[model samples]
Target: MTIYTVTSRSISARWSRYVGAHSYRFSATSNAAMGQPAFVIFNNRFVLGTVSSLLPATLYNVKVEVLDGDGNVLAEAQTQQLTAPDVPLNINAYSKTSSSITVNWSAIPKATGYVLKAKAGSSIIQTIVNDSSGTLTGLQPYTLYTISVQSSNAGGNSQPSPPVETRTVLAAPVIHSFSPNFKTIMVNLEPVSQAVKYSFIIIRSDAVGNKIKKTITSTNVTFTDLDPGTWYTIKAHALDANGIPGDDKIKEQVTIPCSPNDIKIQEIHSGNLTVSWSASPLSDYYTTFVKRDDGLEVMCNTSLRSCYFQSECGFIYFISVFSYNKVGQSPPGNVLNYTTAPCCPMQVKDLYVSSDTIEVKWNPARGAEMYETKAQDVSSAVFCNDTSTICTLSGLKCNTIYNITIYSYSDIRGFNYSCQKKSITTGPCSPSILTITKVNPSTINVLWQQNNRDAMYKVFAFGKAGVRSCNSSGNSCEIANLPCGATFSVSAVATTPGGKSLPSYSLPVETAPCCPNSFSVTQITQSMTNVSWTAAIGAQSYTTLLESYKGQAKCHTGETHCLLGCITCSTYYTVSLSAISETGLMSMCNYQGYSSSGCCPSAVKLYRLGSNALRVYWHATAGSVNYIVNVTSDNGNFTCSPMSGYTYCDISEIYCGDIYTVIVSPVSIDGSMVMFCPMKMYSVSCSMNSGAMVIYRGKRSLFHNKA
Candidate 1:
């Protein structure tokens, strides 16, 4: 590669004799001359180099000549034209699954097509590329990958791109959690000539796709709780599926493997597997895992340094750890064990099984890159691992047990076989946690107990309610247009990378009845009433109750004279009063048709006739058959008596001078005064009819006193 340059200083270190002349040559720049070129020497003293990096691929003309002996051209050399460079390399990526990874790169600008390849060690992980992109299916978590692309044309070949790299896609992030200190992994892709976009995916080890994984356009991505000490490969490729290079292909780059301490299990319920460890001495390593014997893979990267592996009902699992970087995988760390046993489990101390997969973990053999694990179902047995323990074995019949063997390894490349450890068998998975959640008034969200290797969410609507199915990460669903207050039946199951979970169901759940709003009462007749309410939202017709009362005070008071499915203004109600809705939640007002109005003049009393004593009597405005009379004097003299019919009372104890008072009120069937009027007083009157006598209608008698 040549660079553009102007001669800076060309004082010859030592002069050499010109081939065919006695003259010698020297070089210098015009700027360095202080004011101008020290001497006029066209092609000899002022030598300039072409700027290759700055030169565009467009046409450029070049001329060359050789100066011999003196500052003069001795011979003309070659003239050349520069052409634009072929399109660089193109690259892109996608996922065959949550665990598998795919990547593609553009063919060389002048080449026929592209050839794709991936390397972990010297071992080619994947190779083949009639197409630009190729999938590396079923990769292990926390593994580093060296990805590359070379350009080819009929002319033979151009140089290969600086090694492009990518980590296999990491297992999805574990635990859908929100916290303040969550670690964010920032992936930096190499700078290319053009501004291009890319697609990325983040999956938790035990989860289905996030159901909402965000596609980041920026080169750097922030992921929380990555598997520590484990190498995670997040692929970056051009947005074009054809891997078409726009102008310059971006150099593929994988994330630096996180430290093992950063990878950990966040939580566990059945809590069969969760890996927690302190920071290791190594900086180039990152990854933590709870390997299931059930053929499920689990890994996490986070500072809290933990990973979760859920135990199914009959399955078992254990944990293993390793840290690594670009150069190579590190020795394996300590192994931890756990299990989910059913009935009588003999392998519990060393192993566990979930469905067909069985997992086993033991104390780490020092210096192991990982442990080699194997499983034998009722049928077939296979060994798969360069270096790793806690292997998952599959292909067993449902609910059946199988034997397992484990071995220790020093280096995956060096130690290819398993060492000795105890043997065990597999078991079945636990019943999925079928939870019903209300997402909205019209929708339900169903989910199951958490598992690292979970795959899909299945919902079953069955029985008298008929049957239906919906797939989602949310375990629950919204059943729309269901009759309010109607009973419904439902069941849910969870699918995992290892196997399927058991189904759980809800007891006859029922929808709530709608309660009416805007309740009101109207007088139908002098003696009748009507009540009404508005329709409740998202529910059956509003339930209404009516009550009749005699005053401005609302007749509601939780009383109802009539029960209404639907009431218009003219609904002639019997004044029935009752509570409404499932919970009887109601407004403050009662059905006024049946409830009484504020008592009118609770008690009425007549003024005094004389000063010595007073009498009290009253009458209710409504139905009443009897009354009562009580009398008290200002001097504290008091009396009481039962009275009927006529609403008046008179007491005798006439005195020449003294204030007296009287009260009159009505009584009810309960013998309590339905209406009461307050007492009034009058100074002793000389005449008992003083007030009435003043209103005498007849003309005063002017004639002589008749006998």
Candidate 2:
């Protein structure tokens, strides 16, 4: 018997069954004789079937027989897939730039190799047998490509794979972001890969869209030195390993302006009255300049640009500068100026001219150095002969008339001009005699011969004494109020219609002291003297000073004047005195402290009646004075002075109308002695003056009012 197996259920490929039959040397005739069961395996499962003898070349239905120790039919199973003649693999179409693609199916199992189809536009081109993956070289970047694949077998050629699309790299890089006006931009490259190197090209554009390149750098870039308030654009892209680039690019359009439009100018410190306003521009600066108060102006760049003005306490000026660039200057900056100290016309000083070559000298002005001088006739026709501060007149007429004026000038800009400041005429070239004399301790007289009928005299007296002057047309003049004993040199200038006469010199004059230059009789206390004044301005000190026909001594020799003492109510006197100046210049006062006046100080007096009795009284008309009496009639002694004090006393045995003298004094130690007003008396008349003037009596009669 032989075993049988089924490899196919039917000629269909959708659902298939493969059955195997197990038999012990079984014969085909037994399959039809006994209706025997058979064991078979189909598609990894077992099934029971009836067997039949089938031809090898033709399709057959068969099964296997099974005994006790052999296989027996238990169940039935089937397969879902079946195959007939394995198809060869092929590539119908694929992405040309891709490395691998799908292989198509067709033909029978006996095929040896497959073919890959490459389509060029509308035509089929190259073919490969052993590989399904295909690669094409020298292809354009970013170009579309199509391809297909097929197999070759013993039966025939197979169908090709489905058409596929792919792309090739593009040729040149395209710029994305390059903003010149913005000064910065973000660059994003397409197809980012290590195989590709990127670069950025930034350019400044002209008005006509022409490229003005600043630099070529990396893909990410930053640019500076940009102008504000301008418009620009940016472009960017990527590059491939083959020096080829993708066509993808990006751009950004914008404007740049981080700062203000115009420039700002201001002054930091205007030092002097000249008003130094610095031409400082705030933002954009190209140049600077300053304009003068005069129509003139000075460039800040010029070495002589700075100028000075004779500015008084309060004044103002206008100024400005323009900020510029290659295109043009920005808007003209605002005009501004500082309020400077006012400009005062300088005063004329030392206006004297010399006849010897007419050399003239004077003092400098406060803020001015240059000065103009005119030595000419009253008519403007002499303009050509005029000169400046140190000028000389060659043909000046010696006897003719001329006038002069001088002016001082100053400037705030680089260049400055002079103005006429002060002037004085030259002498007539003739010598004139002059004499200075002392009029009194406080007066001085200057005498000079007249130059002409119209000439004037200008006398200047200067020395260690001080500055003094006396101007007159007469031959003789005096300067009063001068400190006595002062030595002063006098210069007399005689002038006529033409000019001044030759200056005449006079010997220094010194005042004399027959009296005091400074004197006072000020009353310190009632009837008290207190006199003081600065030692004579130029006086010699005196050791002995006389007043009231009485002499008193000052401590040192330099004492000019001082109070003598509390004097009597009578005419006193003053005397000439002397002292020394701080410079040791000695001077004397011809005057002295004034005489005492009867401004009416009260007066007092007294009389002595006899021994042991006296009377005292006062000036009943003015300031009252108390009167008291104390006497030792034997010697005419008393503690009271002037015989005037508080009380009058009576003693027994004192003779009335007796010839007894007494010293009169006051109650206080400082009270006047008999020297104040000597008065003597002796008697017993002790009592208040207003009370009574009666003789003493016994104790009982003392109460009887001395009646």
Candidate 3:
């Protein structure tokens, strides 16, 4: 075998020595920094050497001969065993999924295939590929892989490349949830990769190829300013550390519509309110807004064109409407103002009356802001207006009726009053008392006080005589020509337009009794007289009042015949007899009288007539028809009518040694005049047998002389 000595450069050249091909050619290149040359022959044998430019651990076949310049082989040698190539350079692993991994490296010279080994701690996997990049299947998700690559030939394997610690791509990000509104789309995903960022691609289904893209460092993203009532397709992916994207997922959602338009109020009533509006084409339901001027508001939802809500009486409110869907609420529609009617007022109550006044009270009516009270009479009318529910009316006529009415009104609703009529009357006062101011023997006068000026009075005089009356419009009245010693009862009354008041309490009056006109002495004697007079009418009794030289004297009697006994002769007497009525009325009658002239008896004496009798006598006067003798003392009086037709009379039944007054009166024939004898004091000292007491004393003296 021989080696070549000279070398030349050629782009296309013919071969001089050949081991297999007939037109084969060879060329060699060397590294300048290694300072090694090629194509040098030595030691008389042509040596075919391995240069450093050739691939490591590779086999080459060469042809050697002694030919001068012919393309022929005399001696030849070829290697059958191929060696492994050098280790792969710059190995990297990326783009991991839940079940697969992708590895890449710089290609090695003379390498037939590559052996890729992926290790996660104790777990390992191996694969072979004839290319610079390989993907390993059936790998764990979201796991760290210690990856290495080696070049291999038919002979053996090269040293393993520098071990590269890289994590398989985290599992593909899962789409958790998504939502689409009128202006925005929100997306949420579960992280399946160890990725620090995510990318969202939102594409409208209606607008093909129109997409909205955004990148965020979190697992959630939101795309805004999208069309309303539109459907969108969303795609989300988690990016790796090398800025490569994993498998992405898709989800679909739609947005809501805008607000409804042209809202209007249909009707407003005391209990309910109705509202209607134009329905929105993209809305699913409607919401009505009802609000009052007093800061009250309410909301209700329905799918119909009109909606009803309960309304408060006498309140003014603003109405509006809106449309909404599952996404969100919409803007409100045009607003309208509404008002309700006021309710009726309650009836009047607690009606009462006082002296010359009336009081009216009532309950408050619903939705009433003010009230008016009117009271009307036949002569006048009164009105009161205020916010209160009570009123008082004054200055009314006594015992008069008045009509009352109340009116209720409000600002929101006009005046509406439904009330019943009421009537009340004032009461009258009491009348005054009747009195008697003057009275006389035959006339009576009466007077009374008047409470009311238009009152009437009546006076009546009664008792003993009869009844008498007189009426007067004034406070005073006079009843004339009434009997004396008469009594009267009186009363008064007052009247008005309503009714007559009760009569006043009765009063009593009396007149004086009349005096007696005639008085006379009918019969008279020396010692006594019988008197008589004309009796006054209505006199209960008569008193005989006398004034004489002896003293004044008074006597009361009910009989017409009176006795004035024991009169002194030649003495003048002034006597008055007064009459008293049952009512204490009094009057008097006067008279004058003197005792009659008569001869009185002279001396009177007494003598013993017998054992049971006494003799009394006196000198009789010439005018006496017979001498009337009497024996009188503190014991009793005893008289003899004619003294036995003698000037003396004997008195019997007299006790001896007892004193007595003997009287003798001279009597007239008509029993009108009498004369009184001088009374004598006498005693019977001895009996008819006077010697009996002398013998009794002489016998005692004789017995004493003998003893």
Clash count for each candidate, listed in order shown: 108, 101, 7
Candidate number achieving the greatest lDDT relative to the actual structure: 3
Per-residue C-alpha lDDT of model 1 across residues 1-707, encoded as one tens digit per residue: 12232111111122223345333222222222243222223333344433222222222223344466554666433322322324335555544333345776654333454445556786665544454556765555434566665443322223344465554433332222111221344554443323245444454333433522334445555566654333333434433323332222222222233234433433354435566776655454455666666688767654444555555533345666655555233445556555442211123233445655565555544445555556655576666464443455555443443455554443222342333334443332443544666554334555555443344666665645455567765434455544443445666666654456556545444445434445565434223345555554333223344422312222332332332322222123333223334444322223334332223334444444444444444545544345555544465544454554455556667553445444444343346553333454534545655322111111332222111
Residue-wise C-alpha lDDT for candidate 2, range 116-187, written one tens digit per residue = 555556744555565434455444455556755544433233444565665554433434443333344334
Which regions of candidate 1 fall more than 4 Å away from where they truly are? Answer: 1-350, 355-357, 361-546, 549-622, 654-656, 668-676, 687-707
TM-score of each: 0.26, 0.25, 0.36
lDDT assessment of candidate 2: 0.43
- Stretches off by above 4 angstroms in model 2 are 1-354, 358-427, 437-444, 450-454, 463-466, 472-476, 495-502, 513-534, 541-707
Quantify all predictions' global Cα lDDT against the true fold: 0.43, 0.43, 0.63
Compared with the true structure, model 2 gives a TM-score of 0.25
524 in model 3: Cα distance from truth in Å? 20
Cα lDDT tens digits for candidate 3, 189-260: 886547878888888876665678888888877777877766778888777677767667777776557767
lDDT of 3: 0.63
